[model samples]
Target: MRPTLLAVSHGTSDATGASAIAELVALVDRALPDVDVQAAFVDVQQPDAADAVPAIEGPVVIVPLLLSSGFHVHHDLHGIAAKKTDAVVADPLGPDPRLADVLAERLAAVPGDGQPAASTSPVILAVAGSRDPRSLTDAEGMAHLLEQRLGRPIELAYLAARKPDLRTTLTAHPDAPIATYLLARGFFFDLATRLAPGRALTLPLLDNGPVPSALVDLIVDRYEAAEANVI
Candidate 1:
């Protein structure tokens, strides 16, 4: 039997957040119709990896729907995979050049009055900050890739737990747009928007609508990488 793809996320209570994750999983399922794709969470939701892993009958791949390698990836998902012999954990979805393409697309497509032009105004990459050094490094790596793709400098800011908060970044630039480094819409993105208000143009990640093609490809790539070790 083909390995079952277990897509896990840091769950959220927000309806929009839940739906966005579901949609992304659905896209993965649709892309590979023969494969079984399941959704689980690390927290704040049901059917976490601990519960979901035991129920699966064959080889499994746990792909974290996270932007960076944080506690959830290092501790939670790794802990769950350690208990199961047939399960393999995939890397988090960030620090990839394809994601930089996604961020550039989002920045270019931002509509309305305050949208910043790629050639002129500065862009800030805003992420849900982490205390983990790996997570911070991953975010910076992504920022570097995005900067290369856009042919401009991209500043890094955090919504929490890091230096140069969104407000400070905004205050300094005063006219730059914030390219959200989030996987979905939730409290973090909400707080980011509120911080800058009208002054910053915030772009959505995967929530509130359809999943992007680049993200879908990235998900498939991670799953394939893990599946290679299934035997």
Candidate 2:
């Protein structure tokens, strides 16, 4: 039998956020029709990842739907895999150039004449900040990738839990548009919109629009890589 692909996300309370993640899982499920794709969360929803892992019967590849390495990746997910036989944790989805391509596309498509053109306006890659240093590095790496894609310097800012918050970044570059680095619409996305009133804020990585093919491919790559390492 094929090893299970356990797609884990950070979880969100917002209904749209939840739906987008569900859609992402559905996309991945379709991508690998033979594999059993399962969904679980680290917080703000159920079934919790801790419970989901133990219930699975065979080899499992725990692929984080998250964007970077942080407390959940370094502690929570890895800890669960350490205790479970035939289970291996995969790298998070981000810091990849493909994701930078998505961000660039989103920035280009920002509508309304009220917002500055993506070409003219400075772009700030706004992330859901984490206290973990590793998480911060991943966020910066993503910013660099986006910078390369846009062919312009990209500023990095946090929504919470770290320095250089969104408002501060805006205060410095008042006309900058935020390229939302979040997976979906959630508290931090909401906060980003609220903080930047009347400013051009790009949609989250996963939105009401069709799931990015690049993202779907990235998840499958993570699963295949981790499953290979499972022994």
Best by TM-score, which number? 2
lDDT of each: 0.85, 0.91
Clashing pairs in 2: none
Where does candidate 1 clash, by residue pair? Answer: none
**How big is the positional error of residue 187 in model 1, measured in Å on the Cα after superposition?**
1.3
lDDT of 1 at 66: 93
lDDT, model 2: 0.91
Which regions of candidate 1 fall more than 4 Å away from where they truly are?
111-118
Global local distance difference test of model 1: 0.85
Worst 10 residues of 2 by lDDT: 112-121
How badly does each model clash, as a count of residue pairs? 0, 0
| Highest lDDT model number | 2
TM-score of 2: 0.96
Please report how far candidate 1 places residue 47 from its true position, in Å: 1.3
Quote the positional error of residue 185 for candidate 2 in Å. Answer: 0.8
